[model samples]
Target: MSSKLSDYDYPLPEALIAKRPLPRRDASRMMVLHRDSQTIEHRQFRDLKTFLRPGDLLVLNNTRVLAARRFSDDHGIEFLFLEKLGPARWKCLVKPGRKMRLSATAKIDNVPMHVEEILPDGERIVALAEDVDLYAHGSMPLPPYIGRESDPADDERYQTVFAQTPGALAAPTAGLHFTTEILSEIPHVFVTLHVGPGTFRPVHSETLAEHPMHAESFSISKEAAAKIDNAQRIVAVGT
Candidate 1:
């Protein structure tokens, strides 16, 4: 049967929402699904290695989260830089799109930014001035569910230990539960998939088929591709 958007909906209590990270990364809860009997079990992240068998090629997304959230003035207007379209032009989503119509401009952190084009789905292609340092001025683009402002600590907490690439608008959050100890014990390789804002956009259409999918960039190395091809089983491990 084809799925409607409501088919994927389930009741989620506000109390169950985790607003902050645990003191230890590996201390988070893990839910295991066994295919043989169709069983489910709850465990800790520390037990992950036990679940993997020999010759399991663990694929990890090492795309790092960009400090993409900038404000016009004290969060009066939020500017989320989604992707760099050109040297100075960026694909972005501006809050209050009605106010910032086509060609609207603003000075954020002393850097001039202007709307170059507007997409029909409420995204805009914006142009930034030379030497605009988002890493220095922009805040972490935390999901709205977090319900708080991004702090300095999120710079470290939101990224994976193996995050070598720098392009994702949002974090590969599943990687956050991994620790150095766990990674050292597992057979894993890195891939890059810089997440875009569309990944988290809520589905408003009656059917999921009606949802407009946005593209995100990705990269895979030659050696990683070879291993994946020869592996007995491939287990992807990221959001």
Candidate 2:
């Protein structure tokens, strides 16, 4: 069935959103839902161990979000890099799209970029003049709802403890609540699903069916797959 874009609209009060991560990763609150009993329980993230048994497998997405937001002072432009196309080429979304049309280019702080192609979705295939160190020069691409500029603290807070694989534009937020201590106590498998910019992109269509789903790259290790197959039940740790 089709759903209108407006149908998904709900008021998200700013107070309900978290401006910063908790002091400890496992210190966050957790809501436990019992399907059979139709009851709900509130607990700390560390208490997650109480709900699982020996044969239960916890699968976590270990994809890491890149520090992909960069500002160009020369042209007063901001680039949110999405994908790497080649050695020195990337797909990026440029702000002030109204002024920076096709063929526009910018050179900011010795990092040069040119618009190679304009995609149908309004993103640009950008060619870098040289290999740019996005991690060192760019800021974390934080969600706008957080209502603040990215900071040095976000470099570690926004990432999961097990984040090894990179390419995600956004972190698998559910994984953020876990700590090394919790993972050591559970039987777990790690999977990679590099989150895309679509995590923050709103559906523009009137019907949900008409909205195009964004694609993301993912991979599973043989060990993880074996663990998944051997487990009695699988518990996805992240959304």
Candidate 3:
């Protein structure tokens, strides 16, 4: 059967939307829909450990969220880290797009960043002032739906415990549920996919095939890939 766009539509109550992370990472609820019985099982996320076996490889993105929000002259400007095009050169999405220009200066908590160049779609290439560590000075790149400034706790909770590479603009929400305890119980491998702003963008095409997927750079080391390929089963977390 051909799948139509309408067939994918389903109603979700506003109250069911998760506006914030659960108090405990593993405390969030999960709904398992069984196709054969047409039944839904509501369970806690931690229960996933009971269903998995040894040699099951869980693959997850370990890209760290960049603290890209900057404040300048009491005005707020948001920059989403896209990719590191070169040493000290990065592709980023700027907010209040009209105000940013080539050679423009932006400050994150007073740490200066110079706009090195501009790109298509109102994006900018920016370089931070020498010796400035962007991760230390920037704020968490929270999702737009949250509609609030990123808090200090977000710096830790928004990122996966295993995240090492630092370049993602958003949190891989599905991975956030895995705690160190859960990770120790199940074998997992990490890969880097510097997710850009496009991950959050709505799919615009009437047909799924017509929707363009934004290219995200990902890399898995040969050793990691070999482990994944040889595993008895694989589970992917998040987009």
How badly does each model clash, as a count of residue pairs?
0, 0, 0
Model 1 residue runs over 4 Å out of place are: none
Candidate 3 lDDT over 112-164, as tens digits, reads 77888886656788886654545556688777777678888888999988888
The 10 consecutive residues of candidate 1 with the worst lDDT sum are 128-137
Query: How do all the candidates rank in terms of lDDT, highest first?
Result: 2, 1, 3
Q: What are the lDDT scores of the predictions, listed in order?
A: 0.85, 0.86, 0.78
As for lDDT, the candidate ahead, 1 or 3, is: 1
Weakest ten-residue segment in model 2 by summed lDDT: 1-10
- Superposed on all Cα atoms, the candidates' RMSDs to the truth, in angstroms, are 1.7, 1.9, 2.9
Better of 1 and 3 by TM-score: 1
Top candidate on TM-score is 1
Q: For residues 1-239, could you state the per-residue lDDT of candidate 1 as single tens digits?
A: 66597777799998899889998999999999999989999999989999999999889999989898888854567888877776877777888787578888887777787888888888988787874665567789999998889999999998988888999988888898898899999888899999888876888889978888888889999999999999999999867
Best by lDDT: 2
Between candidates 1 and 2, the one scoring higher on TM-score is 1
For residue 38, what is the lDDT in candidate 3? 100
